[model samples]
Target chain A: MTAESERRTEIMDAVERLLARGGVNAVTMRAVAAEADVSLRLVQYYGSTKDQLLGATLDRLADKSVERWQARTRRQRECASPRDIVESFFDEALPTDRESRGFHRVGVSLEGLAITDPDVAGRAYQKHLKELADHLTGLLQSDDRSAPAARLLAWEVMGLAHGLGTLLMTGQLSEPEARTLITNYLERLGPQLCL
Target chain B: MTAESERRTEIMDAVERLLARGGVNAVTMRAVAAEADVSLRLVQYYGSTKDQLLGATLDRLADKSVERWQARTRRQRECASPRDIVESFFDEALPTDRESRGFHRVGVSLEGLAITDPDVAGRAYQKHLKELADHLTGLLQSDDRSAPAARLLAWEVMGLAHGLGTLLMTGQLSEPEARTLITNYLERLGPQLCL
Candidate 1:
């Protein structure tokens, strides 16, 4: 990577760390500089404002999340069923590990920001949702030709996964309980998937 | 209301307003005092600290949310079915209007805080989830005779509603689309609700 690009990644990484640790309120230009071990001027050089920095970071995070899911799907056997795809999504989306937990925190933070700040973070959030929805919809469509509402199903799966992730992260639902819930849901959805 | 209790409610209303307008970060003791039109000393006299104030406000919000759902259920015809209960939940949970939108924002902010500050906000968030889950589960159990997994189903409904709310609030899904998605979900879930 070029030196400039490397510095940019370093700064973005710092922003992610701050967001994970303290939500959106914790992220600032000075905090990014301190976290990245660079000067505030250097941080500003990369992103002119906090909103710009956050927007760029959210864009990068969104892309990385989609890429991660794609990689997971690729690792699975070819022609994975809708159930398998959804199970894999839950397995990845749930914050069972520290890394996944941090990612979930960042996601919740972005979600909160998307509601309040519709310009930068909101747009980034919408793009993230659209990309994930499209990817999941395409996978489901390929797996089941007879299912006419694959797109809606994809959105349902995405919504459920995101909500369950929050419940898991917040200690509302245990991991085993969440898994069982998904299993039961899939069992009920089995016939629909086939149709 | 008594003078003391009325004062407490006033302070909390100010907190909720601030939370709705700008999220958790917008809330502080000084800001709360300013919003409440009270002395800063009075604010501290009531809660002692920011965490205390936030915790109390969350507890009140949780209670109010549960109460709101109860009132809705009571207003419905006697013996509302599982589908009816779930539909009512979505109707109330979605941030379609200004008041509901503000409430949703406060919810997201609390959710974000529950991740970072588990002691104060996290406990409150869990209580909120538990109360809602219990309420919904009980309603489903009363409505259905043979459904054994009512609790899990309640969580599923809550999760989906929440995730869908975020999607709607973020403009990823239109109101009509969300309604149709729920309708599709209910149709698929109809057999299970009966069984």
Candidate 2:
């Protein structure tokens, strides 16, 4: 990549770190410069306003997360059952590991910002949710399950994943306990999956 | 109620309004005084620091929400099934109406504060979650469902309620869509309810 694009990428990375560490409130322009190890002028040159920078960062995050999910799906065999897909989804989505935890932190931060700062961050988060829902719904739909059912199931799973993830993050539930909960949930969903 | 207690209650009500309308950042000392229609000194006298005031507000909110749920449960028949309880939970938890929407707004703000400001607000939010979880678990447990299972189910329900509520609040899912989703979930959980 060119020097300019690399610098831009570095700036976005800084924004993500600040967001994960201190939420939207901590992501000031000066803080971004400090986090990125770039001068304030360069940060300004890359993105004129904090809102613009945050919007762009969110857009990039949305793309990257979706792409990562799709790439993971593509590597799996075509015969991967709906059950396998869901089990894998739970495994992938849980915020157990350090990397996943950071992602979850970013997610909750965005969720908080989305609710409180509707004008600046809300549009980006909605787009992120829509893109994710559409992607998951497409993957979940099968000949046995109706499209609407798949959509509803997708939303339910997304909601559960998000909520349970939060619980796990906040130390409300342990990893083993969360796994058991998911297991019980999957057992209930077994009939629906025709498994 | 005594005049002193009444004044305290009014100050807390103002804090809740500010939190709901503009989140934690909007609940400054001067803002609370203005919102409460009282002098700054009165606000300080009620709660010396913002953190102290917020902690008191969260404690009150936790008690009020749990009390409301318990009251609802009391009005139901003794023979109200676990399924009924879960269904009622969804009914009460959904932010479709104005009051519920404000409650949800306050909840997300607190959740955000808890996650980011663990020093000041985190303990209070966790206390809120634990209290709610314990109460729900008590209601959900039965002879057939083990205590562990009941606890897991409670967490799952709480998680779904919170995540779906966020989706609804953000306008990603309409009220009808959220209702349909819960209906589908309840149908799946019907067998587990053993009714």
Candidate 3:
């Protein structure tokens, strides 16, 4: 990678770390500079402002999350069915592990920010959801007789996964209970999967 | 209402306003006092701390939200099927109107807080979810042949409502789009509704 791009990634990583530890409130230009071990001027040179920095970070996180899912699918070797894609989506989305838990925290923080500060975080969040929806819908549509409502199904699945992730994170639903809930959901959704 | 209870409601209302406007970070004891037109000492007399104030506010909001749904169902004056209950839930839960939109904002703020400060907001959020799930589950059970997984279904509906509410608020999904998504969802969930 170019030296400039490397520095950018370093700065973004610092932003993510701060965001994961605290919510959106913790991420300021100065704090990110301190976290990244760079000067505030260097951080400013990259982002110009805190919102820009956050927006770029969220955009990068969005792509990385989608790539993570795709990489997993590739490693599995077989052509994954719609059910497999969704099952794996839940498995990946749930905050059962530390990394995913941190990711979910960032997501919730972004979600709240998107509401309160709808210009920067809002656009980034919309892009994130759109990318996920497009990717998932494309996968579901690959089936010859895919449901015409593939996009809606994608949104529904994404919505459920997000909500369930919060429930799991907040201790409202245990890991086992979450598993059963998804199993039951997939069972009911069996017919629509058209597999 | 007694003077004390009325004063307490006033203080909590101030907290909610601050939360709705600026999120959890924006809510502090001093800010609540200023917003409520009361003294800081009076706010302290009511809450003792910011977390306590936020927690009490969340608890009251949770009850009021559940009550809003019950009142709506009662006004309809008919036995609501599982599908109907779920349908009305989406109708009410979606932040299409200003009042509901503000409610959704406060909810998202509390959600972010629950993750960052679990001891206070987390307990309140869990209670909110538990109360909603229990109420919805009981209503579904009244159907006499409710699915064995009524509680699971309740959580699923709540989760979907929340996730979709975010989507709607974020401008990702239009109101009509949300309606259609829920319609498709309820249609697929038809057999299981067992009504």
Best by DockQ: 1
Write candidate 3's Cα lDDT for A163-190 as tens digits.
Answer: 8988887778889989999999998888
lDDT of 2 by residue, B1-195 (tens): 999999999999999888877778788999999999999999999989998898899788878888877788778849678888888888888888876777787777777667666845567888989988998898888888778889999999999998899889888888999999999999889888772
TM-score of chain B of 2: 0.96
Model 2 chain A poorest ten-residue lDDT run:
A112-121
Best by TM-score: 2
Question: Clashing pairs in model 2?
Answer: none
What are the TM-scores, per candidate, against the unseen true structure?
0.93, 0.96, 0.91
lDDT of each: 0.86, 0.84, 0.85
Clash pairs, model 1 backbone: none
Cα lDDT of model 1 by residue, A118-146, tens digit: 66876787888999888888878854453
Q: Write the per-residue lDDT of candidate 2 for residues A1-195, one digit (tens) a residue.
A: 999899999999999888877778888999999999999999999989888888888898778877776677677848667776777778888889876776777777777667766755668888888888887888888887778888888889889998898898788999999999999998889878763
Which model is ahead, 2 or 3, in terms of lDDT?
3
Number of backbone-clashing residue pairs for each candidate, in the order shown: 0, 0, 0
RMSD of each: 2.3, 1.5, 2.5
> Among all windows of ten consecutive residues in candidate 2 chain B, which has the lowest summed lDDT?
B113-122
Question: How would you order the candidates by DockQ, starting with the best?
Answer: 1, 2, 3
